[model samples]
Target: MILYYALLIIDPSLIGIFINPFIVQFTIFTRVYFIACLLGVLIPGILFAIRSIKSDKPEINLQGKLLLIAFISFTIGALLTSSIPQMTIKVIARLILVTSSLEFYMGYLLPNWVKKILLKNDN
Candidate 1:
């Protein structure tokens, strides 16, 4: 499921009315991009949660807080951008920033940890 979503869309235009935040803009080969993007956004959360689970010391309240901040910032920014296209773009860019940063840091700095959990107990 994560892999499928990662290969979804490149420049996802999640700004439509009825389809807003509901539909994914994708292409043929773009599935990989969307999958990557999805992984970028979620892999961090999964890994963090797993590590805590393994250590028996769950403590990622900060992730939820940061995620909440990101959501609030994106929502407010997009709402304000109702009158400006550039501002809307800025809001989307910020959303991308939040996820991409999480992905890169986790995938890079904590590669071993992610691999260990991702490969763990998959029967």
Candidate 2:
């Protein structure tokens, strides 16, 4: 978890800005949109970590405002970017979002079928 958040911090600040020169050329609106996307990932990760560290329990209602913000940011970023590489990165980011969101869901949401599969021995 620490590694994940560390990457989140590092990616946008150090790697994204430095590695992608076009990012520096982006308008302020675009910059804010990207920042919002980063916040989307970071906020949920922070909340999940805090809740886990405190009680080792899952948090229901995992899909909240942050996830929606992340989704919208990604959509806008993809639409605005003309570069194929940037578009590819957005695609990868989307995959990461889905994977992490699934982690949150399975951990906290506990839908009945998933619970049955995970707790087959429990009555």
Candidate 3:
């Protein structure tokens, strides 16, 4: 991942940039990066989440659900932002991306307040 970012920094055009609302272009590098993300990040995350969800512990199940939502939302947001040219769609996609971060944090950290709310329902 570090090496990939380094290459991106060396050549910014590898990912291509939006010049206008109606114009969108993606370079081969961008496709490769997308595929790398899917394989390296999303797939592992989903597998972990599923395993966690299958555990008997309620806390683990909640965490797994949160992680699953986070990964799915992140993928959707990334896909929308990359493919869609409209400004409104971009804004919505950014919001989804932000929510995914929050979900991931909650899943990883399992804050006490969130645990109380979510796990309480199991009783």
Best by TM-score: 3
lDDT of 3 by residue, 41-79 (tens): 889999999999999998899999999999999998988
> How well does candidate 2 match the true structure, expressed as C-alpha RMSD?
12.0
Residue pairs with colliding backbones in model 1 are 6-34, 6-35, 6-36, 7-31, 7-32, 7-34, 7-35, 8-34
True lDDT of residue 61, candidate 3: 92
How do all the candidates rank in terms of TM-score, highest first?
3, 2, 1
Please, what is the TM-score per model? 0.26, 0.37, 0.80
Go through the candidates in order and give each one's C-alpha lDDT. 0.45, 0.49, 0.86
Against the true structure, candidate 3 has what lDDT?
0.86
Per-residue lDDT over 1-123 for candidate 1, one digit per residue giving the tens place of the 0 to 100 score: 544444334333322232355333334444445445455655665555445445432223333444444444433443333423454565775566666556445543455565465444444
lDDT of 2 at 31: 53
Cα error, residue 18 of model 1, in Å, equals: 25
**Per-residue lDDT over 23-108 for candidate 2, one digit per residue giving the tens place of the 0 to 100 score:** 33443444565666667766665665455546532223333333444444444444445233464665665565565556555554
- Report per-prediction Cα RMSD to one decimal: 12.7, 12.0, 3.3
lDDT (C-alpha) at residue 24 in model 1: 34
Best by lDDT: 3
Candidate 3 residue 23 Cα shift, in angstroms, is 8.6
TM-score of 2: 0.37
